[model samples]
Target: MTIYTVTSRSISARWSRYVGAHSYRFSATSNAAMGQPAFVIFNNRFVLGTVSSLLPATLYNVKVEVLDGDGNVLAEAQTQQLTAPDVPLNINAYSKTSSSITVNWSAIPKATGYVLKAKAGSSIIQTIVNDSSGTLTGLQPYTLYTISVQSSNAGGNSQPSPPVETRTVLAAPVIHSFSPNFKTIMVNLEPVSQAVKYSFIIIRSDAVGNKIKKTITSTNVTFTDLDPGTWYTIKAHALDANGIPGDDKIKEQVTIPCSPNDIKIQEIHSGNLTVSWSASPLSDYYTTFVKRDDGLEVMCNTSLRSCYFQSECGFIYFISVFSYNKVGQSPPGNVLNYTTAPCCPMQVKDLYVSSDTIEVKWNPARGAEMYETKAQDVSSAVFCNDTSTICTLSGLKCNTIYNITIYSYSDIRGFNYSCQKKSITTGPCSPSILTITKVNPSTINVLWQQNNRDAMYKVFAFGKAGVRSCNSSGNSCEIANLPCGATFSVSAVATTPGGKSLPSYSLPVETAPCCPNSFSVTQITQSMTNVSWTAAIGAQSYTTLLESYKGQAKCHTGETHCLLGCITCSTYYTVSLSAISETGLMSMCNYQGYSSSGCCPSAVKLYRLGSNALRVYWHATAGSVNYIVNVTSDNGNFTCSPMSGYTYCDISEIYCGDIYTVIVSPVSIDGSMVMFCPMKMYSVSCSMNSGAMVIYRGKRSLFHNKA
Candidate 1:
């Protein structure tokens, strides 16, 4: 018997069954004789079937027989897939730039190799047998490509794979972001890969869209030195390993302006009255300049640009500068100026001219150095002969008339001009005699011969004494109020219609002291003297000073004047005195402290009646004075002075109308002695003056009012 197996259920490929039959040397005739069961395996499962003898070349239905120790039919199973003649693999179409693609199916199992189809536009081109993956070289970047694949077998050629699309790299890089006006931009490259190197090209554009390149750098870039308030654009892209680039690019359009439009100018410190306003521009600066108060102006760049003005306490000026660039200057900056100290016309000083070559000298002005001088006739026709501060007149007429004026000038800009400041005429070239004399301790007289009928005299007296002057047309003049004993040199200038006469010199004059230059009789206390004044301005000190026909001594020799003492109510006197100046210049006062006046100080007096009795009284008309009496009639002694004090006393045995003298004094130690007003008396008349003037009596009669 032989075993049988089924490899196919039917000629269909959708659902298939493969059955195997197990038999012990079984014969085909037994399959039809006994209706025997058979064991078979189909598609990894077992099934029971009836067997039949089938031809090898033709399709057959068969099964296997099974005994006790052999296989027996238990169940039935089937397969879902079946195959007939394995198809060869092929590539119908694929992405040309891709490395691998799908292989198509067709033909029978006996095929040896497959073919890959490459389509060029509308035509089929190259073919490969052993590989399904295909690669094409020298292809354009970013170009579309199509391809297909097929197999070759013993039966025939197979169908090709489905058409596929792919792309090739593009040729040149395209710029994305390059903003010149913005000064910065973000660059994003397409197809980012290590195989590709990127670069950025930034350019400044002209008005006509022409490229003005600043630099070529990396893909990410930053640019500076940009102008504000301008418009620009940016472009960017990527590059491939083959020096080829993708066509993808990006751009950004914008404007740049981080700062203000115009420039700002201001002054930091205007030092002097000249008003130094610095031409400082705030933002954009190209140049600077300053304009003068005069129509003139000075460039800040010029070495002589700075100028000075004779500015008084309060004044103002206008100024400005323009900020510029290659295109043009920005808007003209605002005009501004500082309020400077006012400009005062300088005063004329030392206006004297010399006849010897007419050399003239004077003092400098406060803020001015240059000065103009005119030595000419009253008519403007002499303009050509005029000169400046140190000028000389060659043909000046010696006897003719001329006038002069001088002016001082100053400037705030680089260049400055002079103005006429002060002037004085030259002498007539003739010598004139002059004499200075002392009029009194406080007066001085200057005498000079007249130059002409119209000439004037200008006398200047200067020395260690001080500055003094006396101007007159007469031959003789005096300067009063001068400190006595002062030595002063006098210069007399005689002038006529033409000019001044030759200056005449006079010997220094010194005042004399027959009296005091400074004197006072000020009353310190009632009837008290207190006199003081600065030692004579130029006086010699005196050791002995006389007043009231009485002499008193000052401590040192330099004492000019001082109070003598509390004097009597009578005419006193003053005397000439002397002292020394701080410079040791000695001077004397011809005057002295004034005489005492009867401004009416009260007066007092007294009389002595006899021994042991006296009377005292006062000036009943003015300031009252108390009167008291104390006497030792034997010697005419008393503690009271002037015989005037508080009380009058009576003693027994004192003779009335007796010839007894007494010293009169006051109650206080400082009270006047008999020297104040000597008065003597002796008697017993002790009592208040207003009370009574009666003789003493016994104790009982003392109460009887001395009646």
Candidate 2:
């Protein structure tokens, strides 16, 4: 019998046909086991038989026998031990690369060779090798492949080892081009085959090992945030589905030079400006540009870090700098805004003059920082500085022509521009030290000092009555028609052809009082008189004086009336009334009057004619034409008059045990009565026969009894 096929569990064999045979029986046994062999019986005329239940990759002894129906051997055929090899164990695919995969498995004892099968999608590939390991070539990159290894000898290939799932690494990407700028770089690459993603790494060539890495699903990638004016090395690779990286593709590139930094102004002159800046790396040269406010441009190029350009004065400019190399020019650096120094100032206009000050104005300069004004005369010079177009120069000589100059200044040193000299005349100086030389009841004289001798002066007096003015060419002037008893603010102003000067410091003055009018005196008592007059226009108070050969008396009052007391009786007096002003000026008016005799009835003699009647007699007053007596008591009051030319009076109904007060008034020939005269007292007493007795008392007795 000849063995046909052997497997891990079964074996098949072919044998020659037995003549006149009944059937054939086949048996299989393991060489390592001491068990009965597995047998199979075949029918007559069978030439092929198979044995079941056989161990895989084991030495199996197979025998086929031709037998008759009686179970006796007619002929037999048996061979040596033969079996198929065991299945390969621990199958693995490793060392995977783009378009290649290596499959490996445990070696089978006495195996002739090993076969590797690799399948991807619907495509399959087989490779044969004498060793236990085999490689599959020309496979797709980054593809998932299932692989298996089988050991083969005289037996057909054992069951393929357990399948191994693996994927090939992606291919390396190709760099197509690089885009470089001042601060960034973009890299372009060819697409890798079967790549799920791509990886990139960038390293600065001049720096100390700073690596930037990125992974993306796209083939084209750009590296951002890179340093300018630097050389870099970029690497790119593809990754498989398992995240395994392929070989790297590397390239080198250089970015454009960076912009110049930290621009500064070195020097500024009347017609030129010099600027500098910090140097930029990888730059071969630098260029500076300047643009004026009027749309004019100027540029300078240099290999160094600084440059200079011609400029116009009194102009504004915008400036910038850029670095350049063989690649291109970098972006412009920070822009600089600059203003040139000012030129000479324009014509001065709007010149205004006052007493001691001159205001000067001019058209504005293009770039002036401040303006200055100077005024100079024969005796003095004044100066003013201001940022605006106008300035004032003060404390200048009055009524004088001054040479005025305006200057425009800038922040730059030694760049002050001056205008042409201008001539201006100031107004007259104000009159000073005002004084009132003389003050009258209705007029005043004023004097002042002034430097402008050729100037005309006007003196003004401001009062409650009205404003009064006087004009004079001299230093003194008199103002007339001033109201009396009024205070006036007096000042002086000087005027010339230029203008009027400011008013001088004011001085306060008061006019003298007017004389009192309508002075009169009226007798109030024998010793007192009422002096009255019309109110004076400027009088603050009134004073009355009464002078006689015997003595003198005076009284003062603020009203129109004053009372003069303590006059000598029956004496003539000169009554003088003066109206006094607030400034102690006075005017007087006089009147003559005669004082009356004492109001009491002096040297009185009383006669009792009847029990209720009494006769009274007294000395006559000098100015009296008639006399009247007033008697007062607790019971009642009574009055009696004497004859027209007499001074004696009679009292009727004199009562007993009663005290009486008697006042005697003198009536002048004009029929004016003088009251408040001295009083006399009398007491009436009753006698034993009922007769009334009259007792006379003096003026002191009347006052003592009333007190």
Candidate 3:
């Protein structure tokens, strides 16, 4: 016999008796039957079957017997225990939280209460409830939970429904910090337990309640593309795996203003600097910071785009600008630099020339640290410190005109403003007077008082030798090769810076005459002598001087010969020739000459006898050979010897008381008579003695010649 379990509520009865017997009986029984059984028959075989009430999902025991001609047991079987319901079908969990969850499932037919279980990794939680849906409390936030549901009716709990995975809602994120840029907001969220993602929301503080929302996987979120200078609120929350958000946290912030543009340095003075910039659209005010490399930093704020401040003198400053609003400050804009200029001096004065230097002076300016000076035509420039207001420029040309410019300067800025330039000409001083310092036979020494301004000098000597010039830097010069004994219009003109001066007091100078080149006894005769010599330069005339009382003679200029007449023979004399200048300056040369001895004797005497004789008388003649006399009227010649120093001689052979002619002559030692004749005389004497004409014949001769 076999027994089978039924899946559904359906029954059919069939029984078999012993093989060919008609009218047989069959019986069956069950341990889990609830009521008595009934037998029924339909065909030939006798079958006993009953409809029994059985408990669902319950195990039961059953027995069946076959009677052959009597009541006897044939077969018996029993079934194992059976289950009534499986784990609840189609289990679902909803509304998950950190520590609790809601579960739901299909209903069980006989269930009296439901048990739901939720698990994370090892922790489990369970609850019993009569309704199909129930909630579990006290669950962790942002935690994963596996949930299940069961339906029960005293048959024991059904197998737990297939596990349904669910995660609890995460705790809301707390806003830790929120920052705003010009047009963006950044929100940092506090970590939440078991959170998967964070959501950030930005809302504007305006009437329209404008808002922006963003989600990110990290703990922080950034919202971009916002308005500048706008106030907003940032809200942050954590989300679970199922995209459900937890509690939210909020933070308030405002964006920064826009940065300023086009920064510029407007004006710079000796002690101040001005700066300006373009205004920003969203800015309420502007702020500036100024600094120099070696100075302190300065900051100021203003509603306008420009600002001015006291600054260091001649300093270079770096300037930066920023825009500011009620919320925050913007980034710095473009940076710029400015420098202050130096001031100029007030006045220039005291410009003069001293020696070879040019001196200039000035009054200092308010902020001048140094001074600069330059000449208009010169390339070099002069620098002076602020301590001194005067500058001396040396090594300048004398008697020159100069244009000078002066200015004050800062140490770093060089020249700034300049005084009016001045023009001046140097005055030239007078040279010393010229004088004839020395004299020579042919040259004169000329000198003048020395002067620093002298360049050259001209000496004009007025003499027989015309004019001449001399150039010198010193005080003295020579008028050379001048005529002797010549007077000069010696005047010197010095060339100076102011041109040449008037000739220095027309000096009159004379050079001593030169001695004759030569003088000697040229020739000596009894009557005359000749002298010759060379003429001296610049000599106007020549003079022959005989110291021994010979003679005085002169030769005109350019004459070199002189003659002396009537010189005594064999005489010793000092002869000198001299050169005389037109100015009466004289130079002499000595010479010796002798006049030639006389050839004929002077003062010869002649005596005559009447018709009887004559006599010649004469003195002795030097250098004469003899003396001779002649008579006329039948008288003979008479002769005298020079050796006798004879002065007279008797005449004879002439008739008594007769007229006679006679003459006398001197003869030179060479027998050449001088041919000079003495006066002739007649020798005639008639003397009448005491006897008269009666005895005339006897006393004839005695009458004519009276002794």
TM-scores, each model vs. reference: 0.25, 0.43, 0.32
What is the lDDT, from 0 to 100, of the residue 444 in candidate 3?
70
TM-score of 1: 0.25
Cα lDDT tens digits, model 2, 332-406, are 778888877676667787477897788877888777888777787887778788888988787777788899887
Candidates 1 and 2 compared by TM-score, better number:
2
Candidate 2 local lDDT, residue 107: 82
Count of backbone clashes for each model? 101, 4, 28
Best by lDDT: 2
Q: lDDT score, residue 185, model 3?
A: 73
lDDT tens string, model 1, 471-572? 776677777777555667767776665456666666666655333444654544324555555554444554334356544423345554455554544345
2 or 3, which is superior by lDDT? Answer: 2
Q: Which ten residues in a row have the lowest lDDT in candidate 3?
A: 691-700
lDDT of each: 0.43, 0.77, 0.61
What's the residue-level lDDT of 133 in candidate 2?
84
Model 1 gets an lDDT of 0.43
TM for candidate 3 is 0.32
